[model samples]
Target: MRQINGQNSTSTIKQYSSTLLLMGSMLCSTHLLATTTATAYNANNYNAIQQTMLAEFALAYADTATALHNYTVLAIKSNSTTVKQRALNVALEQHDFKAALDIATHWVVQEPSDVPALFYLAHIALQAHEYELAAESIDKILSHDPSADLEKILAGIAPESKEDQTVLVDALQNSQAKDNPSILVIIAALEAQTGQFEQALATINRALKKRPNASNFILMKANLLSALGDEEQTRKWYSKASRQHKSNLEIRLAEVKYLIKVNDSMLALEKLEKILQKWPKAEEALFIAGLTSIDLKQYERAERYLVELRNSSQYQNDAYYYLALNAERKGHYETAKAYYRLVDGSLYAVSRQNLINIYTEQQRLNDALRFLTQERVNYPQHASFLYQAQAEILKKMGNKRAAIGLLEEAIQHLSDDPELIYAEVLLLDPFVQRDRLDQLLTLLLDLEPNHPAYLNAYAYTLALQNRRLDEARDYAERALEMAPDQASIMDTLGFVAYLQNDFSTAAKVLEQAYLLNDSVSIGVRYARALYMQGDLGRFAQILKQLQQKHPNDPQLAPLNSLLIPPPMPKSS
Candidate 1:
């Protein structure tokens, strides 16, 4: 049986067993059985007692369906709230959402003030996708307790379910609680979470009118304006809110964050300085100030702020990481290494990667390899990534053969780790070792068939061979379906289209892909498609841009040849 909302099935069954025992004892009471007046009344009482006994018998034997049916009938016939609640629990335990909804609705109708029943009804309705019923139940809940946590109640709805959220939003708008500031706040938050910035802005304005000095609402308005692409208005609102709530640290910090987001590092630093002056020990403000100083290339100021936070429990690792970054920027290699070593927790992997990069940059390949080998032993959880890093360093040193061999060795010990396998597949020459590449891709697809990256790789490899265009297109389309926004997958699809001689479709998708990512490979493909479509103007424009941006890229050599004028005839 499935656990409901973290409630253990065994415990729920035990609770139901206890309830059945109590009901059994009540039904077996001699006094009640003998107190019947009319024959008809006694007959009905006998039937009820027999049904209760049967329900108890079914529950005792773990026959949940039988118990649920009897309990549901008993709950409807009797006005006992306890029976109704018991029936609802049985329905929930059996994973019968339909029955649970029915019982919960009946319970709420019988006892409108029952908060627990109302809560169950709301959640069950949401589970059934009955958004309007859920909204109505929520409105009832808020009517009883204005302080109800609507956010918590609505948290079960997936954030990506924008349609359901829209229905819920509309239902709430028509509710009697529409004017309630708390409800309006929740509505605005839902709207904002789903990217309805204009609607969110309007809803938040309504909430602010009800509670003008609400700091969270003010920040929401500013964020919504930012989302709506009105940066000027966003900046104005942030400034206005900061001035109005001068003592509110959260509002001030939000304004500082907005400034940093807009690349106004100097202004952000100034704001952080003011906040630090008042709340001198505010670690968050100090951290932001340190990062902002780094952005502005003020290393000394960054160090000053970061050093003060080195001992902070919450920001210690982050402070060390940034301090390492500061030292690295100033060419203090030893100091940077020492600070990086001090970094731990979530930043540890990043710090180690940076250390490896420094070694590679200084041409200390042996040292980088030694450090990675030791790190793999010290942090075994990161072994796969460390091996990949080692392979990258070897490949950078012009030993692609050794890199592939090392990955194969790693795979032997790690038992077919997909990352190592994929890394090795990428290192192989697709044209020379087509069969091996295909084999690895087939294995990868078997392991993770729906992985968009693997699908794109397989599709691109097939397209590169200029064979199996149909199969390649299928895989590319599947990958695009899984990750619609990924430009690389789109490029693969476009490449497949190009190989199939569908230049129109190829140009359309490749143009979008180039616009999204603009990698050298994607740009080349887009330029080729445009050229094939006879759009010489667009083709020339893209080719020129590619040459300017990537003059040394080998892929551009062919396109550059097209622009060369024919040699003049010597006879002329």
Candidate 2:
């Protein structure tokens, strides 16, 4: 059974579980016996029971089991169309595929002309692996609307096993829907999914034979060829299809995507421009054009296409995010901020981070603090992180005391929140607040000894102060085990090895860290290990590379002076 968590609302249930639904076969069999024998003859009683059950469901006071039971009784006893539909909905909501199929079959029998009922029956049958029955139901639906697109509906027949899928394909092939072009498309797609490329190509060729000029069929054939690793043939077929039908928007879009995949962005942009010129209202084309412009670093052109998408409801927020990114790239911070505020959904988190970063970059520390204060009030759930962000700005401004004070205040509200605790521990310098740093680290490690961040921070601190070399190595190793790919943690291990005079191990570990992330600190340590190992040539070369990137870097100056060679003899 598919369990939908916590949502008892009817609309929410309907939205999420709209396709390929089935009640458990065992539950349906049990209910079928009761539905046949004990039918409620009176209409008034059934109405009253349905009303009571609906009220309970609406109030969120009834469990799914109770709702299903009540609706099942109504479906079997009552002749009302509304009552039977409710039962079908309830069975789908409970993810009982068999029950849903049983109710839906009854629904279609009662209302033979109902398109939705026929489609629901087909969807349930497909899910239950009754492929012939599903084909029959789908045929009935297509009889009502011969031109209806069954591609999306047929796409839902996803079986767990390759054997089940093959059975479904065979059943669909032998059934009444064998004559349907859309059904053939789905069959071809299934064959492709199972890696039967030749079989899929044969199926689509059959489809094209029926309608030689069908652009969708041609596009499907091109896609199959592409999947079979024949890129040249795919492009050739796409070109042939485009000549056959010049104005198919889907074909044009597919061709544009192919161009982009081949790294011919300029040509893709040209095709997109033509598509936009012909179909000015195509929001999808406009959105892609904007992103393509961004990829090509044509920020001004990106703004033009993205701004056009701003009027479209589906793409507006995403367009805003891109527009903001383009403006930021152009160094228009104020415009970028405005555009970021207009962005929403998952991108909102990214926009919020960007706002803080932009404020910091512009040296507007006071403004950032003020914004963080307001954000704390408005977004209380995220207030803990806001405190850390604010403290970081204060620390960067050389106000360590103020930063520590701010974290202490945040802790009173967030008490023992792991991130806040971690941030506070980092701020406590051992030389100045040795007792406090030790206390916090001990407490944090006691709470979550396996936490990679806490372990790395603790280990790096011990290594930095050059005390307890064995303990530091242990902590660093533990952290590396937890997050082996983390470059900073790898640096901690190398730094500890250096303190213990394990120059060989230090050089190896620090070299790995440098490869992962060529940061200045890691580079300096790596160079030092090389110099100690008498690999003076590589050491000088590494320092030279770091100096080029981080010129006037104080860390590099000390390391550079250490590698000075003996003065050459004047007599020579």
Candidate 3:
């Protein structure tokens, strides 16, 4: 309700604007040209005048760009302080910083005592990168209120780069407010961002001496020590802070947060439990506890904490989302679906995704497709994703023919989205339609030559066919270079070497791949390489372990053929 001029936000601007309109209507009835011409006019004339004023107010909400222009015109024509402030608000809302600065400067000139005007002037100056002007405005505010806290204002000056941070620090240090502890802390935080950790520690320690019991300084010092890699000293300071600030919930919560960051969930949960013992219904503590429980795989405890959060209106939607996850983790499909349906707002999209995943896992393909169809209607721009989701469900159901047909139809509509095209290539049968498979792989490689998936798939396919060993080796090598830690790509390189009769190299690469992934396919390949290299004992050991681990996997038949000699004694 604050006036656009320098008034506090809680002021009754709506009431004042209404009174002004009523007075304007009354004056229009007697002295205005249009109404005065109608001598016998009644409420109709006053209603027309009221409608005119209402229309102007409605314009402010209808279209921001047009409203800004109209407000600027009104301010110029009437020279009213209120109208100028309205223009300023519109300019700020539109992110037209130059216009906002001009309006705010005019407001200050007209109403010199307006503190909000000066603050906004500084804010706009900072955004425009007019550092000197920003400093001048900040100094005016500090001079106006000697005890003003510039922390919140300075916090807005986020520098995205080292040079930007240095510029901001220099600008702020030159200001009269530089002597404030809050300003010193802001500068120290910026210094830390620029990797001047030693300078940051010195500045923060200086501030702590000035205000020894300030929790913020203590926390900052702890963070600086952590950044400097002094773990022991950091823990000491954190413990000291919690002991000194026993009544401060934020200080206690900060310690728990640091513990969680360092992956010390046991200690974090212990501190959280102690905090909850005192304030059982604290929303933030309950939320973090719910997340920690989920991370620790305590589904029941997570559900309990998240359900308690449902009582707080602010976290109702978030609580429902977490509750859905808890039920999903417990394999309570119906319960999770019910919880997901109750979720709304920004969580709606993510909850819908979870529901799709749950339906797919449960093999309720129709339900998943139904939800995706509705989602496609709701978000038409995401049609490509919805199509791919349907195809994925078909693929999971072992209906590759239907999945391929769906992708073909989708490509006709969407026309060569690289992701969809790549997906279609994955469904290609290399044995039945080698030509078509090669064609699609070639197009995919052309689309994204450096794509690790494309490179690995092409290399693995060629290795399988044994037609282009050198090309396959090159592609697999490129894929390994691109994703050095990818187990599948490493297996591809091993398989290519095996096809080229490099059994020793194949054994080494497959061994690495097996260690990286422990996949049955990689283990079988490693076993085969060892068998071919005459390491019969090691091959037998690996094959036995694979049989025990996989228990009659059909994919292990080739390795089994190599291991078992087909009843040679029975012929004798």
Candidate 4:
């Protein structure tokens, strides 16, 4: 035998030691085979020794596939559990989960009470998506070791896989460990994630029975009640939880959030004030109180809470944005602009938009354009949006040609940007630039085929020209289906119907659209549809309402002719 020594041999021996640890009891047998005299080996043992030597050589050289193959053969031929375990470890180290699963299953069959083998089998089955087999292995492992970490195993499952979640739920429901409160909690969470609120409620109630004072379970129950739309029960349970867990900030804050969700902003503010009275430095309570005050239009109180939050690192940007909103609502334009400039991160885009709106409302159009131009250079990632905003400011200033020119320049830089193309399409006069409008609309659809706004614009433009009314109707219907509650899409569909002379359909759909949003354009179409359908009284009522709402709307000028009485014939 060659003497093993030196740095290289020491490294190889260390690797062999780790490999032996995987083989468990086979380590001693392997050691004895290596040490025994040559005369002691019989023919049968000689083949086993030769294969073991080959596998060890493969491992030392880092030939994982060869090692796994030889080990798997050795494991099958021998009845030694350590040999099978070694093969399983080799397969696992190689990330050969299929071979690992097969070897683990064989190992378990040989030794049913092996906890580690069962654990490995369970995880392998989960990886293979063999849920039933995984469930069986998990059950067996739990039986052998009651303290097994089931949560760690279940964590691998995705919450979005409702079908897979349901299978696991059923298996756990019938499991020997079904009464485990930890298991019940996870099951409840999974049920809630899958939108099985009623079932989740039942599961959580069971956990609450085991641990009655568990604040998390109580909160889960309340949220489940909210999900089930039982508003009264949700309120009652949240109140009960708050009363029971007086020191628990999470429970109290959850109650405040629930109040806000139910639109009880006044009560939410009151609760938040109480929370702040106890925990004076609570940043979350201060933030919520500021927003709640804003909702109630108590500007002074909102400013006080928001100013305090400006010192908080977590809520600093959010506080600045809301402070700006509060100042704007109170008509302190300069203060609002100052606050908006300090806002950044995720709120930066909205804050900049607010500043632009403030400038526009103050009739400082040039200032708005200059600010947008500077922002585009500072934040190149938002350049397309800034260009769109600049174009709108130009349009507001009665510079439509400049707006179109700016958008054309933006499109040259951002050729694939759909929003820039759509903005330019909207700016183009349909009657004058028909081909260009059609070309951009086609391109916008290619970018986002199912975009409701793009589809609606295309349908409205086609209807405006009264060409291809059927195709226009098809596009409008598709858009309406995509955004069923969007009033603008409804208006487009109604316009398409009116263009096709389906006056009755137009009158019905346009009335719904008008009721949804009484915009001037939709109101005009509804009035015309009612007029064409011979509903003269309703048509007159709609005309009167439109005139009352928008006395000087240019779109309503054409409708004045409808109200004029026709010339009477002379009597003979």
Candidate 5:
């Protein structure tokens, strides 16, 4: 009794004096006993025990249970501070937590050293997420328990070893708190992890009250806002976090991700450039920013970022891959190939393929062949690579036999592939016996009758043999149906018409094909049709040009002079 017997020292004592001159008996009364349990609130039921406390106190007897009953009786009688304290205790026992919270708050404002009251109030405040109130309540108890009691209380509430976690847990339990700064800090982490950005932002704001300038919190808040689709707010938070946490790499990276995802890749690039200007080896930042620029089709800018990162062996793989793509976009084949070689992975395969394509495009067929042949040693079953290379080489060297072997092998290995089918059909042409080659064309037509390659191959072969004009015309017309724009097939169609004596149609198809690829075969066929047309002057003119093209060719020279008048014995 002596330990907690004295009047409150200052403001609390003054509050009591203003209310009433102390009743000597009330002032000197024995302190209330402590109770162990806490209150729980129910939204549907309002606690009615505050209206019955005084009556219950007088009839109480027996143990703490009876004491609790008496306290409930006293609390029910009035809204007085003493009644409020009793109601707080009874409310805690009945688990009428909200009522206990209401009473505890009232008691604390009136009297700080009401120890049981302070303890109850702090607990309620903590549960209610009123962190500052909870802390204030507990601190007051410690302040008065001058004999190291506050430390003991806090130690007991949140054991020293796991205290931070406990404090955070305690803060979390107070879901309805008016302003719980501590709870906000921890929820910031929780919400970000779960992708619950909106709730996370509000929770983190509470933490900001505790640490207004905390960089991590600011960054987290910014990221959450971004996730919530609040870009302007997100930017504001990002800027604040960057300023507050100047050395925080994560904050800067977060801002970069936001800019990239929203298609504001130009801004992302500028930010990344600034970062690289400051810290040149930020690999992840540079790589992601480069990819963003690539997505935006800003190839030149993407290349600059990639080239800067290419200096380090660690980043070399990625740097080279991105740089190769950039060079490819610019049509710099050799430059692309140089960059492609440094990369390793499945991406390396794409790089090799792209390089092969560049060689074929430049008509450096031997280079394309050698690369794929080497690749085949390691990837022997790669049908497309093997066939593309073989086809290009054969087309250049005109080695019909060797080309046939490769085409047959490609067809056998990749029977369902359209590209390989096209290459295979091309090989069937230029053979001596049209019948032996015609069998392959019929097989291809059976496989895909509408396929232009199959149509053109069969039609052109029949026309050249001059043996089946009706079948040739049907095949050529079908090929024209699919790729009316294909010059090679157009020539076949024209020649078939000419063989059928449809000279008007032959001239039209030939002229169109001539304008398309300007192939020698089409030009000669057209000149022949012109001669048969009795347009001798035009026919003569065409032969003169053809002779210039064939120059010393024996077959064309006689044919050429026979058509044109010998250039006047002009010289003299």
Candidate 6:
């Protein structure tokens, strides 16, 4: 038992006492016994006991005095060198860094030629961010034989360690993980994150040998393979898991889901039907069956599955949401509204706001306002819904003050997140009180000088105000450089050029942006630039095209109702 400061932990004894408090607590046998017990030496049981011991030790050593007392006892109970090493590891995990160092220092002095002891100390120093101490510890290991294989490995290795991640990364990269298969799985997971699909695939294959039935390894390997566009192999691994564990219904369903993703809906449907036959009330299988139908565009089958699911009293957020999409497609706004409401006021609020679009499109202004009011009541501080509601309602009512007030409220949550601050600046740009927004912008530069959103927002605001076009132009260029292909960034750059009467450059940039994403806002700005440049022919072409896409958009009225003046004839 580890001590705290100087006190002997009656607490370690307290845990063994508390273990009797609920000897029948929720302990999964699978966690304690990964396989049928043939011997007492089970790694899974060892793992469980190790985790529980770690928890107890961490609590006991909250005071350093108690930790030292336990360390002295531990030093006598086993081979001094080996047991002392384990104590150092436990101390480090408990965040008693000085104690870990003290133990390591003793081990080094007692066994001056112990490479493992020196390296352990090096790792402890690294964890403390004592890079100088870490280097010195490693140097002690290298001094032993200078040419030893162990010394060569530690010295040759560059520790990009990146914290606890170092254990897995160093284990794999240092080529020491062949002896410890658990390290192989950690390496596979790390490589998967870094987009090294091939290396990740090979590592997972190696790890499966040590624990062939490790579900996490199989699932991760399947997902990584899927991410690399190998849908066939992804399903194969899931099927392999299914075959290994005959009664694993969830894992078998994972295989079915993968088939649906790969466009083999018929095969996925067969599996879903089997799952239903086995357990008729399996809501997940039913949900996926409906979703698979939706993916295949078999709308009739999707409607049937969804209707049956709803009748059976299954939880159906996805089903209801997709059915809402189905209703919207069939011009049934009232039906769509009901399903959308089920998902409305949820932490996931996008489903409801999308329904607002339908209300807006149908010109049911009262319904849209009612929906917005309800959303405001639900998520009181969610800036997105509040701002959208304010923007829509105030724009409809021509109440700029109320709209700007809502936008400003949204800005308060966005003080540290530069993107939100930038959006707030644009929303406030029309107001006379620019000082409030300018304050946020100046604070933002100290945080994110090259942020795409900040660069574009500052550029566009300066351009719109017709002040400091040179500064605006530079910011716009910087925004484009940060995110070259982003449609909104390109629009800012084009608008900055337009403000400087560089309309030719504006037309080029804006046209390129419009090609990438035909956003109504970008279209309006680009068309306006073409008109400013006296290129009304090009402007009219773009305007006519844009109006067709956004027929009921309020901005479309200006372009459509006003006849374009005739273009001067070209001299051949």
Which candidate number has the best TM-score?
Answer: 2
lDDT of 3 at 21: 48
Q: Give lDDT tens digits, candidate 6, residues 152-217.
A: 222222345455345536534554223344446546666766667898888888866766766666
Give Cα distance to truth, residue 554, candidate 4, Å. Answer: 7.2
> How far off is residue 168 in model 4, in Å?
6.4
* Model 2 worst lDDT window (10 residues): 16-25
Off by over 4 Å in 3: 1-98, 159-168, 206-218, 297-299, 311-390, 404-572
lDDT of 5 by residue, 1-572 (tens): 12321121111211222123124213322111112223434321122332232335432432445545544444444334544544454455455556656666656665656775676676666445456666666556655653222212222233223444445445445434324444355445545555556667778777677667655566667767877888788777776666666667777777878777777778877777777777777888778877877877888878877877877657777789889988888788788988876666556667776677777788787777777677667666565756766675776778777777787777777776666656655666445646647766777787888988788888888887887889989988988899989998889988999999988888788878878875566778877777776777877776777677776656565457555666767575
Model 2 scores what on Cα lDDT? 0.79
What is each predicted model's overall lDDT from 0 to 1?
0.83, 0.79, 0.78, 0.82, 0.64, 0.65
TM-score of 5: 0.41
Can you write out model 3's per-residue Cα lDDT over 51-100, one digit (the tens) per residue?
Answer: 43554566546765565665555544433444555566666657777776
Candidate 4 per-residue lDDT, tens place, 131-203, comes to 6787788778767666554544544443357777787777777777788765687688888888888988999
Residue 449 displacement in candidate 5 (angstroms): 1.5
The most accurate candidate by lDDT is: 1
Clashes of each: 0, 6, 0, 0, 15, 12
Using TM-score as the yardstick, the better of models 2 and 3 is 2
Candidate 1 residues 1-572, lDDT tens each?
11124121212222445556456546644446567553424555566667777887798899988888988887777666556656777777687878878887887888788776677788778766787898789889887887554544555443358787788788888988888876787788888888778988999899889788877778878888998999899999999998989999999999999988888889889989999999999999999999889989999999999999999999999999999999999999879888987888889879988988888778899888888888888888878888999999999999999998888888888865788889988998889999989988998898899999989999999998999999999999999999999999999999999989999999999998999998999999999999899998899999999989998999999998877889988995
Candidate ranking under lDDT, highest first, comes to 1, 4, 2, 3, 6, 5
CA error at residue 450 for candidate 6, angstroms: 6.4
- What is the model-wide C-alpha lDDT for candidate 1? 0.83
lDDT of 4 at 236: 91
Judged by TM-score relative to the true structure, which candidate is superior, 1 or 6?
Answer: 1
